[model samples]
Target: MKKIWEFIATGFYSGKLPKMPGTWGSIVAAIFLYFFWPENIVYQLLIVAVTFVSSVVSSQSLSEQLDDKDPDSVVIDEIIGMEIAMLGIKATLPVVVAALVIFRIIDIMKPPPIKLFEKLPGGFGITVDDMFAGLYSNILLRLLIWRHYV
Candidate 1:
């Protein structure tokens, strides 16, 4: 039971990956999502929803366990944010590459309110900040797509 809770809290061990596991996890999840669903908006949105909720819950739980503030190891937030960034965008190689780079940059820089969100306590802070990052990335991606293709 304890182990199960830990696993769930840590994003099924994806959070435990060495180095920037969260980024890696997000990348993998995005790749898998693209391959599995391809151009399906429904599937992409579903993935975003699930990732958002799960990341919030998991980040909070993991923060409690670690007894530290927003440990880098717990990266479910990144995974969720990445999914949000990719939502509704075509899963083409160029788009995916652009989204990944943009999302990572925004996430790392933690601009404006995104940086502000980190002030919140525990998992809420961790997850919400990244969600905002994802949202920022999403908006930019949308504009880029619209400008170029639409």
Candidate 2:
């Protein structure tokens, strides 16, 4: 049913927040990462992969149902993006905080190819730009860890 798709796409209604729903959804994602992130890198990758697939399906369905390209009320993309950003990283307090900040900034800024990804059709358009932002956040986080900057 559409409710199911809406549930998934809205990150279980976190996206229904009156303001900055994406940020609220990302916050929910950060909480999920803090409590549930896998210890094994392989499993972490699997989680991201699954989240990506689910987000794509749900987002596309929700968009069509709502007749919008990228509905503000659909933020499974943010959840999946934060998941990707936190992938393979230790879920320490500092790391979680930094990941949230970085992912949000990159997502909001939408630099270069991140914005371009929005041009894709359906949920691919809805979800991938956030994934790219997460990728950028992941790379930056890894670099900071490598450099002992964080």
Query: Which residue pairs of candidate 2 clash?
Result: none
Point to the candidate with the largest TM-score: 2
Tens digits of per-residue lDDT, candidate 2, 61-135, equal 999988999999999999989988888899887888889999999999998978999999999889999999999
Computed on alpha carbons, the lDDT of every model, listed in order, comes to 0.75, 0.91
Please provide, for model 1 over 1-150, each residue's C-alpha lDDT reduced to its tens digit, 9 standing for 90 to 100.
Answer: 446545654556776777777677567656755676447788778777776666667777767777878877677777777777877777777777778878888998999979999998877788888888889988998898888942
> What lDDT does candidate 2 reach at residue 126?
90
**C-alpha RMSD values across all candidates:** 2.7, 1.0
The TM-score that candidate 1 achieves is 0.81
Clash count for each candidate, listed in order shown? 0, 0
Off by over 4 Å in 2: none
Residue 21 deviation, candidate 1, in Å?
A: 3.0
